[model samples]
Target: MTRAVVLVTGPDQLALWQPLLTGTERTSAAPVVLRRHDRRSLRGWAQRVEMFHKEDRLERLHELTGGWPLLVDQAHRLHTELDDPDEVLRRLAGLRTDLTRAREFADAAGVYADPLLAAGYRELDKEFADGSFDWENTVTAVALGGELEEDDAHRVIACLDALQVFDRDGVELRLEPLLRECVTLRT
Candidate 1:
């Protein structure tokens, strides 16, 4: 008799299982990391949006989103409700403070249901409200005078990255311009 139990977390279980279960005796499947699109790749994604084939519009979208795929996808989804794609794209680009839009993003991104992530966001939100966006310091504060371990802080930061709440390049962590503006307005 054999018993097997499988536990999976996150939005994509297949993304986890694909590499782990595909290894053979002598060869292992190469891991694939799906990164957010950069400007050039974002241009390609914009072009694929139905009826949006103009180069100038694509350029505008690229400039607005800074190559963030979720922002690009949100703009693409706006075409149906609004008459002018360009106008709608512009609004979506600048509408981060809209409570409705924020809730939509949180829901779609699954951050709304996560208490740990919510706490982290609250801490960062307070820092943003205070005109200081020092994420490293924020992480340290959240960890409570070294009470929490470093790995836990890293995991929180990683979750924030996955939520597109901010960008991390090596040691530098900064909020996206739009998110900063939104936080400013709310405060």
Candidate 2:
């Protein structure tokens, strides 16, 4: 007899997998969600692909993609196709802008359709609207807002976590670079 573990990956959308994996199935399969790369890991990925970019340019690429593997691969492809580095960044910026707009539209539609989701979005939007927040302060504000019950707050936080909205550093949490960019652009 042989034992093996299989890995499956798909879009970040959890709703897509809900129907396929029931409680028992999920318990047996034990799905493990993978997060996007950080700056260091993304740099390693670029090196593996034989893509060498200057530090500043690479930093910008990380900012644009939030180290998402697919977007990083797209950036690599664009870099190979374009002769000018500046042009590559410019093109990536345009693509990121389009993606951000599409996400905004989708989020708006979702908020309109679901009250709980709307509350989460509102809390997030209000927190990050100023482009700065102390993690503790933000959490306190959300908990004390009086609009969201404790369970609702937990759900909202879990939903945002599933969406990869925050990067955790030790005890602190902050928005991922790309999400911060989107918030900045919105304001």
Candidate 3:
């Protein structure tokens, strides 16, 4: 059997690099040439990644960001116009508390109600913390600022999906514990 070296050049190049690394057992290459980019070529590279990058990016996102609540909270906004027929906020908050209490979260800055709170993979502050809120309390609170009907609530999730804040399935948002606290924000 001969060695096959695959060289991928681009941002979001993880996909190309993934198969090369994951299947390295099969493909014999002396240090594959996986050329990626920095901030300079970020946008273009991201486009390429989107074309080829699959669950790797999302999984990486989850792994880096502690859990999916950051993703889900980042995705949807509170619709304060209508009534929350589904009580999404309540469900989501419960989820956040659970993820936090379970020690599932990494050690994140400015997030623990007590030092006991595990801020799993908190290096992802830029991802979920980028929201307009101040902290987790505020981020989670943002959802409670408004009342939303089922359709409007879904629309919030949809908007988040479009932004890539959550996956197409919104699994990050669907987690049982987090979904239970979707209604507690007031500002």
| lDDT winner | 2
lDDT of 2 by residue, 1-187 (tens): 8677775634344454333332323444554555778889988887787664678887887877777665677778887897666777777677446756646633432332345544564566677653555555555556666376665465555555545666777766666666555544544
Task: Output the better candidate (2/3) by TM-score.
Answer: 2
TM-scores for all predictions: 0.59, 0.67, 0.19
The lDDT for every candidate, in the order shown, is 0.58, 0.59, 0.30
Error of 1 at 184 (Å): 7.4
Candidate 2, 15: how far from true, in Å? 4.4
TM-score of 1: 0.59
Preferred candidate (lDDT higher): 2 or 3: 2
Error of 1 at 14 (Å): 14
lDDT at 127, model 3 = 34
Model 2 shows how many backbone clashes? 0
Our tally of clashes for model 3 stands at 32
Of 1 and 3, the candidate ahead on lDDT is 1
